[model samples]
Target: MTGERDNNGVVGVGADLDSLFAEVEALRELASDSDKARDSARVYDFGIRWGALLSGRLQRLAHYHHRGELTPHEQARYEKLRTELRDVQPLAERLGIARPTIPLEDRR
Candidate 1:
């Protein structure tokens, strides 16, 4: 039998896969929250990287990964987010946000 399905009908993700989603989700939430707070509260990270890391985008990536359905464009996006987040994380923390150690991509 196939393992359990996620809400979107993705087959059961392993612990590590779940971790990947969690990391991406956290970063997305942080980015979105920071953007929302940019006008009022203090936003830590700077630049387009913040907008690039938005929840909606990351959520779509996760959904695509979940269904094991990534087009070339999406694959590029997946890699881009992972790389960009890695590149900008230190700056984000230095500027103010406390990021989690978990990475956006989980090793297979």
Candidate 2:
């Protein structure tokens, strides 16, 4: 039950982020179209004037294992994100995200 899919196998926010990545690629291709390049230019000039935000912010179903340890900052962020997750875990569950009942460290 703890994965990118729920007990019912619904895909989660990862899929949504993947779709967003695809949309970004399509937008780039559209910008290269000479005939409608002006139309694309307006959107692109505004949109990518700033770089796109990576989907790295999501913590759902994420593991912080880097050689089996977390840095102090990452541990802090993990604790904070874990606390924040309690608020939205229900909704996140609908999208196929879950946290284990036991802490990962304890589990090992």
Cα lDDT of all candidates, in order?
A: 0.50, 0.40
Error of 1 at 53 (Å): 5.1
List TM-score per model, in order: 0.43, 0.28
Q: How many backbone clashes does candidate 1 have?
A: 0
What digit string (tens of lDDT, one per residue) describes model 2 on residues 1-108? Answer: 233444433244345334434544444454456554455455455345212322232333243333223445444555554454354344334323233342434234
Candidate 1's C-alpha runs over 4 A off are 1-54, 98-102
Candidate with top TM-score is 1
Number of backbone-clashing residue pairs for each candidate, in the order shown: 0, 0
Model 2, residue 56: C-alpha shift (Å): 14
Question: What RMSD, rounded to one decimal, does every model reach?
Answer: 9.6, 14.8
